[model samples]
Target: MLHRHPLRHAALLIPIAILAAVSSAQKADSIHYDEHTRIFRMDAADVTYAFGVNNVEELEPVYWGRAVAANDPLPAPHTMPEASSNDSAPTVTPKEYAGWGGGLYPEPALKVTFPDGNRDLVLHYVSHKINGDELIITVKDIERAVFVDLHYSIDPATGIIGRWAVIENKTSTPIMIEAAAAATWNLPRDTDYSLRYLTGRWAGEWQLQKQAILPGETVLQSKRGSTSHQNNPWFAIERGEHPDEESGDVWFGALAWSGSWRISVEQDQLQQIRVTGGFNPFDFGYKLAPGKQLETPKFFGGYSHEGIGEASRILHRFELTKVLPQGPMPKPRPVIYNSWEATEFHVDEPGQSALAEKAASIGVERFIMDDGWFGQRKDDHAGLGDWYVNKEKFPNGLKPLIDKVHSLNMDFGLWVEPEMVNPDSDLYRKHPDWVLNFPGRPRTEGRNQLVLNLARKDVRDYVYNFLDDLLSHNQIAFLKWDYNRNWSEPGWPAVAPDDQKEVYVEYTRNLYGILAELRAKHPGVEIESCASGGGRVDLGILRYTDEVWPSDNTDAFDRLRIQDGFTYAYTPEVMMAWVTDSPGWTNNRTTSVAYRFLSSMQGSLGVGANLNKWGPEDFATAKQLIEAYKGIRETVQHGSLYRLVSPRDGSETSVTESVSSDKKQAALFTFLHSSTMNYPYPRVFLRGLDPKTTYAVTSIYGRLSKDTPTSASGSYWMSHGVDVELKGDFQTAAFRFDAK
Candidate 1:
């Protein structure tokens, strides 16, 4: 029933101080491991991840779910009396840190290949250290001078465990690391295994895939030298017992690395699952010299008993407060306009100025001129490494376009591929040796560009200086830092033979350093990490960039699924969604402007459509939608998100809701892929709202039929959902609800 209140709707809205505090001030021995008992307990909000070490000195997982002690830790295989032999006994092959040892461990967490080709790694617990909010457990090889230290940092308030492993070379001889995983997460074997990961190629990225953790090993990796579009460094494990998103003990983990990475989910014969992740060990070996140490990227994971949405919320909160450069509470992302879709490579000062004017007309806050404003960059084939503006395109340099953009009250952003070089360009001709390649080896070219050897100090300085000069000379507020290709020959002839392999890790490190330097120099400038569309999006990159373009595909229909998969491990704030032309270049799928607008609104909305081609009606609709989006932008960007419906389920409808941190404002986005005959749109149950509070709903998209309640209790709206009978292809709607 609708609640009729005489007072204005604003009178009912109150700051959600209590909810905000709980979300922000949540505590850190919520996770504790006793030395005597050898038991580790990690508590997050409502769930607990517990594990214990057995008598054999092998770390084993105990339980992961709602709070409770692990019932009798698994017995050591050596002590079991079932006529204990090399096999036949109930052996736990999946250890907390798998290594080459007794009882066939399928996936090894630590594998070191010595000069003699010996891959024996037997690490036993040596000691432990407690330093305030973190625990460092050290283990050393039994036969070699190698020590591995596992560091676990727990944020008591959020219950997020930031875990990483450090392999220290204590031997005089340089040790060749065949494979060194960052962390091995052991999940409970009680429920049937189901693994969810994102996979795609090129234009189609973040295509979510879920299946049973089959026998042997299912490795999800990106060996293309970059974090390739084929696989993302994130995973979500859902036990069969609780398969659905809203009702499961969903265990999730992500590798905080932007370079080549891999995650192996090994399910042995017994159905036990052991997931290990870190730098991809294929064609990659880190050589550690005497007294040198190699620290793996932080691989963090958490358990959520409430469901996948809760798991995502926990991750979002952790990312916002811990991972990102801007700490804790972040400002709402502004509406951006990218000139690539509108102008393509034919960008000019006057051409971009016209687009910027059109962009500002529709409430675009950031005007980004992507590509072709620089040297000989008429197309993708040339002028990549050249950072200077094209005299032919921008006769007076980028200042004119930037100034015009700023004149329209929009922040100016430029696109630069600092890590790439055209094989036929002036920069490449000047420093042919600057590109990454082994001597006498044929270099592989991608997008008609070669990867720059940022690992080299000279190359890094050249690139940094040009970028710094560009930003300093122009009034650029943001930079779209793009890396279009991956490493080919994987070499650094400039460095020592042993130091050559360090290029893989050093390149990413130097890239981050450059970004940090740029930001430090220009405090007000923001950066977006774009690598052929989401290829380099990771916690490692997010620390530098303000946002990430998930993919090249802008089809509204396809974006729903991609955005959904992206949010599984990443928050929407970093997701840059664009509304392009009806027939998107990637999918060639035509969708209504409303559908496109609502779809993109789920994240940081951007308009990439050609304003010159838009009809009067299209512009009017876009202007209206842009204005409507601004009203709920803050709530959507920094709120608790609820995934009420899934497009992956093959259903006709998809739904989502976001509630402001204060719980005073909520925005709901719903989409109907295609309506069927006699099949009405089902009642949409609302979520992420205070059940006792009453909310006044106003339509931001579609019209609500008569007899529909204008306002209702949150409980009523959630329990007795609103039903719409709209029949159409690509039907979409949004509503703004204010607590009254």
Candidate 2:
């Protein structure tokens, strides 16, 4: 219920404009196909991927690893020889995309049943075409009219490939498609590979988890109708057992869907690893009539030979330059002040106006009034679907508060949960059939709210029209769009029973359409994606939203671990970290104001603490730290991250560094849990700097060691690291270096 901070890509082609940044030599030959060998190869950054059509007419993975020359020798395409009677050629050979028939059974890429009770389906290559940076391959079933088109594209800067599929039913009868996948990724046969992913619950999302890649299947999925926080749709496979932060081979990928999705990592009898992911198959059946078609969400995969740290850096660069809004170079995240904790559901114009003035004094650029601003919402149990300003709370509507924030030199934002409705609300009373429900089943409720059935065209239009009117009438600059609960009784009675399962895909598609329409209508307004703290986060949603709330657990010490795990899959440019009160709401632990500010400054900085309770000393400290953060905001938000020291495995210290794209500025943050056994913190060596250039160092907090130099060459700083003295429990320090 209100436990804490409530309210809490598209096939994305690498734009041709980005090629100007790459070397001419490297850009000349990025993708190639050899007709003689029936093989295709692509190169981006420092990695390469290759595949070929074998004699049996199946696409087989040839090689995938570090970059190789165009003329490098590779194996010719051929069918694998079966070892035993039990291991047939279909099971032994690694097909890039396979159907669910012909005695093949390692998680089929496509499965369907005919109206005539014939389920056997096998696919073979029909044709191929390459247009500049993208490739399209068409395949069809051996004796049926079902066809599938596979799409692929790679980002030149990050070496990450985007994949998706389009399935078309060309037959005259309705076909029941049971399962489908966007793509299947194959890795070389190796026994030492380990899978790394993120997992946690409500208040504990984004916890880094790892396990050995054994002989069976490891399924990671979310059947909660939204992207549940139980398991994020991202993965990394390490080739060796001793891979560290900065030095080993790492392959990573992420799914782009926000609705019910799955990723199956299976090791077959031949010891090869395969990853098949797309829409989840549980309780799923899509009826494809006559000539209708369906498109899968994009899947992205990448490689980094230098290690997991470099893998994250590649993803960060790709997201900032290609995936985000206003790309090639998007604007920096403005410092925000959210009043969720300050005023909670008791928000009034006068209280928010006061908070706005204090927030402006500390350099907050955007002022967000969370929760109780509308719809008789004094608490979480009622008035969710009714999106009107409460007469008792705001006599003159939101304009008075919006104008007040603007006068204080800050923009105004509001919180809204458009996908939920409470049973006690007027909207629910008038339209009882508007939500997802079965005709004769108990509708389960979470957070005292029912999920709106966006799959229905009427319901979808209603949510869009209300939000469009809200923005059109107000002077709002941002919207904190939140989804606080998962779906239950996910049934769409408006459609036929055979198409009811299409709710999973249609609901998410309509949500995206609303966001895209609103964005086109109001170009000045930005949006944030929040779902009970990171429940609906994925590449599919990020294309339309600006920032994300990682977790509701804002404890400074605990965030060091949570934020560390988040960066493995997502860039810090969109990570919104807040600094709340001392006795944390989650853990009841007290930490100094300086420690809290430093922790939040690592990402897009925001202040959510109750300013009314803060004294003069606290305000002064906040203003000074915020000013320092602005100076390094460029490097931290748009630079290369070097996770020098991890916060896992009970380590006493944590360290991270960020270097600007131009290699001219760098920021370093160090944290200490305790000074045990009288041992000093480790010396910090910097990375991603121009060795020949000289830099001047400045400390934002803590004292530098006596031997530390104020000015030195980049090589000297990299080889002979600087040191800072941090003692006691829950201490932190920050340093900034500028090129001279």
Candidate 3:
């Protein structure tokens, strides 16, 4: 049943008209923007708030939330759930353990009573709150407890809107919680369905099934066909299967999926689970002292296809009462070239400048110099703590290279890993306590690195100032902000024992603060979010970045699946996939260069591999592809994306297309993974075309070199379909059509 609570101070709430106007106006504090949404941020007292609005709809509520907590609980051993009957509800029994400094603490205990005759899931937090718009529920002092808080809120005017859940450490001591947060939507039992999931990582198909047990043994049984398991945390289910798609409405809900964990603690320790919604999860966790808080963030639309799509549309409606005084919004980012895989950690001023010159020579507008330019950064083992230019590598310094790039008419970009620290670095040497660590415990390390405790003001200040200093000193046009790894040795010496689980949430909040500050100061610089590859590619970070490095693996085949999975929650424009050389960096798979270039064009196009090694013919091919991309840049960058083929179907080929909003132009790409005998020239169907308009088709690539205008009724294109022929191994064919 729907619950209705009257606004405590309805008169004080901002008027709808004013809120709409404010939402539409671009604010200086806005960090990220798209054709549909804008994000405005502010600091209220100690908490930082990110207010997001969908500028297209004035009636839409603002999407706002904060990270308000940071703490690590005492560690405890975790026991996996024994196989149980499907009819029985899972029971959690908490045991105590020793605290961080060797003091005895209560074992974590939890009892989830799915009482009869009740639809509301009663999550009894040892501590709970009812006042704020958002709350972060967390568990402290325990490492193995699976603690999560679900916050539900609704505005009478907005209906059943936003909801967010904060998952925390449930063990008495430290334990690594490796899980992806997911929400599975449940459609009506009679609904027709199909499922889609990322292959390789997990294997599964989305065809109609009577029953299915996901990776974590989450049973999703349907009486009739239902799309109820869409966003759940799925791991090794089955591999090499395509995600299923269907032709009916589907329902949705969220799920928190976990990986394995190593918990360390004694018995009898008390662990805390806290929850907060709305603003920041870390900040909310901080406000509550060893208890759960039920605060709401801003509105979180819903889980249905229509609901999610509507949320994006409505995000444009909210306005900011206050905005930082930045100038007009920056122009849409250009198709740039990134020197990451090409150089890795070997980049120096001269090398980078040379690469930049070569890139500029080929009409490459932006030259991004990837990692290895800071501190004594060599391998992944050390030198992350200090954020200084390596004079030994950049003898002439970055300014000259940036100046040279500008002289060559290209923008300069740099990479930074601010949230991590290497044990051997100067910063770590000067302040051993700066990294996240318990006073006397052996700190765990991942990739020979440690996570900086952003919960501490000193650490936050240092990171913020370091970035500010770098941006101030350099004429860097873009910042490729990367979070290469996840959290390990999760400890916050600065926070009290009772509030340690809040550290994770706090770390993320502080990150938001740093990004907010940077955007405010450097309004013209574009930020590209990168996480080891696609690890941190999510809507949450999208609010701060212009684009995201879709993955470190730019092989066209791999991206076919990666980009397909990404589209479930993200827009096509935000995904940054690139065309690189083959043999690929790792697989050494030599795909057709045309196939490689065409796949990357689906997102923000970039060249990641060395271009200097190309032969004359290859250079001509590269030039041709670049020219073709430039010709349709607008349509590809801004047009509607339609999935024409499934990568998961184990198909030997895949196809995708982008059609202009005016329906006057369309770009279609068909990829052939391997050779097929007497290959059926699959007449690829088209989407988003105007049947009413006659169109001309020209083979941008392949043997069909003539431009031909073919009359196609819009209704026929939709009902019947257009076809294209393909043959051979590692092949690609593209066609561009415009109204005659």
What TM-score do all the candidates reach, one by one? 0.91, 0.96, 0.66
Models ranked on lDDT: 2, 1, 3
User: What's the TM for model 2?
Assistant: 0.96
lDDT of 2 by residue, 628-718 (tens): 9999998999998998888888988888899999999999999999998888889999998999999999998777798788899999889
Best by TM-score: 2
lDDT assessment of candidate 3 = 0.51
Write the number of the candidate with greater TM-score, choosing between 1 and 2: 2
Count clashing residue pairs per candidate.
Answer: 6, 0, 128
Which tens-of-lDDT digit does each residue in 163-260 have in candidate 1?
A: 89989999889888878788888776643778888998777788889887777788999887778788999898887655676777788898888888
Q: Model 1: C-alpha RMSD to truth?
A: 10.7
What overall lDDT goes with each candidate model?
0.80, 0.88, 0.51
Give the per-residue lDDT of model 3 (tens digit) for 335-386.
Answer: 6888876788988877787777777766778888888888888878878987
What does candidate 3 score on TM? 0.66
Alpha-carbon deviation at 425 in model 1, angstroms: 1.1
| RMSD each, Å | 10.7, 7.8, 13.8
